[model samples]
Target: MGPNVHIWRHSRCRGAGWALTSPRARSQAVPGTPRHPLVLTETAAVSLLNCLFLPRVAEAASLPSALPLSASWKELVAMWLPAGKASGRLMKNSSTSPLAEKQGQTSMEASSQSVQATSGYPSTSTSTSTECKPQVLPVIIPILLSILFVACLVLNSTSLWIFWFHIKRWNSSLILQFNLVLMDTLLIPIVPLMVTYFSLGNSWLFGQFLCQLKIFILSTHLYGSIYFLTLISIHRYLAVAHYSTRTLWKKKSFLKKLSLFVWFVLCIQGLPLFFVLKTSVLNGTVKCLSIHQSEFSSVYLYYSIFLVTISFLLPFGISLICYALLGAIIMKMSSTSLRGRVMKTKSLQLIMVSLAIFIICFVPLHVSRTVGVIVKYYNMSCKLLLQVEIAYYASWVFTLVNCCLNPLIYNFSSEKFNESFSKSLRKFRFFK
Candidate 1:
């Protein structure tokens, strides 16, 4: 039953008074026995084999001779031996034989290990590395990002078309919104790369130079976005708060120059990024940390404060104030004096709605991440895993939302935006 083993046995036949049956092959066959290889009756063969090979049977009978030898020993041995040997021959050593099994196991384990070691996410890999299969974001993140990227391109393309063709280019509000659309369009493509990188848990899948290039792009876009947003808010403030002010901050030429200055300043502000980001291994995964080491924490903090204040908080505050004031002024305007004044007021209301959405989407993420990063520096603990996970997922959703919201924001919130967009559509349809 276990494995094939060779068995050697002998048997004798004895008859008495023509009885053809005898208990001992003359067990008493000559009391002084020559130790012939033990003769076995069929029963004795099975029993002897079991006793020598099977401890249970052997333990039952202390003496081998104690086996009850049948009168027909020859027939019994003939019946069982061949069958048992054939069964042994047919037995699968692969499953039961220890040496054979161990070898097979070794082969299987090796195959599995090699498979796991091979390049992971065949969806992403140029070549297979089956031996070291670890779950990586490089394989998955790009996919999600690519999907969003395409969507952003399509949506923002519509906005861009409107900005280029339909916008009057004279109305300061229209000019302002057109610039905002242009800035947002420029910002969309960078997301896929960031998504790929973040998907790898902040690991920079792109090489060192590309890594720095990406960070530069990211910082520039961030600063640029804040710059344009602040400009949009300032434009609204001039139009609504200082209604009929002597100077036109809304003038197309001034707005163009302002946009150029914003780009220049953004490039300058993002330059220091080259010094901070470097490739490093985090928990055995390669990542781009803010610095080569914590020695630069102070510097990173200083930059972060500047960015959060000047780029995020200040722009957000200014936008809120501008919109709030516009809403108040629109309410105070003479409904009888102006045609469609209420509709124009509704545009300001739309801008307010868009501003609220932006705050709702991004503010929580910045707050939690800032807290966790600061707390982690002083006391790293498992308790923060929940907060980190929340911030991470929230940031992703927030970013994805930004991709599609620009056009809708203009269309729904700002009537001036809708007017610009509709005019562009009309020109394309009629002229082409």
Candidate 2:
């Protein structure tokens, strides 16, 4: 052969070998290649070029389909040329040089895969981390809450009976105690449902209406219990600080009206909960006490913060001031007789028990709930979310146990309440 013809034949053989060995070419290979090293016929070269260029032609055709017919052909040609050149160079080199073609295709595939993998992997990991599971409250919470439910039911029931029928005289203190008992009684029935909910891993079996009702009752009880306790402290203050003002609080009718007013206000305050509170599926598990999807979640959060502040913090502050003033008065009083000293001691015990109830039962709940509201509104990190969830539920158990503690408080602090309770028990032959 002449020099130019020999060079053309040599180039055609190299190009054919490269095309046959390429990744894309191997995938599209016909089954009739000879068992000799790095050789190709003209027919094989044309087939490989057609296979490689077909996909690029389809991609180029799709671009103009999306554009208007009057769109500039220059832009269309500009976009098509780069993709066409890239495929063309691959085909040309594979056809010309077999050894370089295999190495180049392998590197290209590896780099493309690495780029795709690097981009793809983090997205999956990020999604997994962001979907952190809701915190699971400790199993002991439901157990403890169940125990409190039973004890609260019995104690609050007895307290209600004694105040309603056993006690002969109903003073402002007894009236406030009766209201407190009534709140506890109303709240106790829902505790078993709550126990079941927590025991079943926060899955709410109860329907939506009951879920809303439970939330409303619990909220009402929370505020009512605190408000009444504060009222009792204020009553004690009035009795001690200005003994002459006894007749005003002494009237049963006035105390009854005040208690009624408190109930009215609490019910009004809690009406919003009916709209906000509902049962819904979260993370594929049914949950109760979650706010329904609304444009007003932020509105509800602010309202809740306000309600807690007014109903809890304000009363808490008032109770502290009243108790402090009462403590000052008791210190100044003359206690020459043993009976006077005993009465003074009992009064001090009452004050201490009230303070203990407020501090232990309500403070943690309010604090945790405040943190929860902030976390929910601001979309905090998963770690902060889990922490707030744990605190909120743990403190909630403490709050639920308050009813059981109140009866003990009454028995320990109030001489009249103890006598009435003992009489009622003896009448029932609970203790012979």
Candidate 3:
């Protein structure tokens, strides 16, 4: 006798999900939505109806054992109309009577409102999505992030100290490495807050401004580190394979200037995050910089794709090409001395480690995040979106590993710096 049943029985077309309304309800527009509603041919009404009403209908009346699960609309009427004369009359008049039409229209309006309230990429308000909760994030991501923070802080601080005070000679490669270290170190102060946030079940205690600042710093660190690693790869390639570029490689000023440019570009890229990265109080807890905290537009989706392409993909490709070429150049050399073999071994190690960072850290992070952005904008199913969210967070945790692994690059790429770092480590009683 409910209006919901009348709306579905009178609907002329089918739709995906539990759309208990006419086709007109599908055209309701939200952010990132097209002007026209996307039509889906799969019928969900029967299943939804059976799921919602069948058990009660069966329990109220003595149902036949031969009742088919895929009962037609008329069959459903026959099965349920016997339960009560009132419901039977209501069903009979639902199509032809004006009052029934009015009830169905009212039901359509209510269902449309519910759909619009729940669907879309998240907006400025808190999300009510219960299906998209990540099960492993609270346990896995916080532990990984904490371990990464400790390891990266110690390694990067030691590297920074060596580069600043112990190693007197600075070249293009050292300049690049030092800049990379600075990026990693800059991220150090932000990690504990993030760890605490994840540890406390994604609840952020910090205010909105710090939330935006945290996201900005994280973005800057990720892309800045990628840029410097690519630069290091190219510099090493030129230094080892092309003797003619040695003089250029010896000049540190060019790299310093380039580092400034990189930071400027990163700042430009991260500036927009402040507007979109907002904190929302959900279930009385503040959630910061969550994908669910803001609405996504078509423009934002395109920008995210562009960022993934340029910031992550482009640098990863360049690093791969440079390392491949370096590998080839190292292979062609016929040197048999210990020093030559040592350099060759180190070069190969650098290639593997750098490629590991790219593959493990950058690739999945960008791909999963970009896919998640697309899925969110298109308002995909909660299960698919949940999978993407899991992948994105896990890959993001892997990205922090790069900060710990990058110090290996300094040791591999430069002999003098490596010796200095070794001596510094040996001075510690722990290393001794």
95-200: candidate 1 lDDT, tens digit per residue? 4777867765565454334323331212334343222212333444456667778887888888777666555434656665666666667667567667666665
Highest lDDT: give the candidate number.
Answer: 3
State the local distance difference test value for candidate 1: 0.57
lDDT of 3 by residue, 1-432 (tens): 455545445433123343533364454334485544333222344555444344444544545423453566686567566764544555665556788678666665555554455454233324434434433354878888999988998898889888999988776778888888899998999989988888888888888899989989989998998998898898888878876655666678877888899999999999887677677875567887565444545766887888888888899889989999999999987678887788789899999988988888788888887888787777778788878877877887898999988988889988878999878877896756
- Any residue pairs clashing in model 3, and if so which? none
Question: How well does each candidate superpose onto the true structure, as a TM-score?
Answer: 0.58, 0.70, 0.70
Stronger candidate by lDDT (2 vs 3)? 3
The residue-by-residue lDDT of candidate 2 on 357-408, one tens digit each, is: 8999999988887777777677667688678787788888899778977887
Score each candidate by Cα lDDT. 0.57, 0.72, 0.75
TM-score-wise, the better of 1 and 2 is: 2
Candidate order by lDDT, decreasing, is 3, 2, 1
Instruction: Check candidate 2 and list the clashing pairs.
Output: 15-95, 15-96
lDDT winner between candidates 1 and 2: 2
Poorly placed runs, candidate 3 (over 4 Å): 1-136, 244-247, 430-432
Which TM-score value belongs to model 1? 0.58
Model 2 is weakest, by summed lDDT over 10 consecutive residues, at 1-10
